[model samples]
Target: MKIRVHVSLKPGVLDPQGRAVHHALEGLGFEGVEDVRVGRSIELDVADNTSDAALTDMCEKLLANTVIENYRIEKVG
Candidate 1:
């Protein structure tokens, strides 16, 4: 089976990359841009029988920074 993890900074954390993108967009005349955020996507392949708990453990331990970031997992295939 295949899975994907999406990791993102928490609400209160500052995202410099997001800000840079927003600024670049404005410079290109893209108006009405309110806010921006940056995140990451990780794809994994595992046995079909892999348990949800094990996947959660992977996210909590390595895929995401639990202190400042949140993670969401999706079973892709």
Candidate 2:
């Protein structure tokens, strides 16, 4: 089975990379842009029998920083 982990900074956390990208977009004369938030997508291949709890555990332990970030697990195929 394939899994996709989407990780991103939580609201209220400052994202320097996102800010930089937003600034660059503005510099390029892009208008009507409100805000930008950067996130990461991680793809993993595991056994079909992998449990949801295990996946959640992986995110909590290593995939995402629970303090300042949020993560969503997606099962793909």
Error of 1 at 63 (Å): 0.6
Give the per-residue lDDT digits (tens) of candidate 1, residues 1-77: 99999999999899999999999999999999999999999999999999999999999999999999999999998
* Tens digit of per-residue lDDT, candidate 2, span 10-30: 999999999999999999999
Q: Which pairs of residues have clashing backbones in candidate 2?
A: none
Mark the regions of model 1 whose C-alpha exceeds 4 Å error after superposition. none
- TM of each candidate vs. truth: 0.94, 0.96
Best by lDDT: 2
Judging by TM-score against the true structure, name the best candidate.
2
Model 2: CA > 4 A from native: none
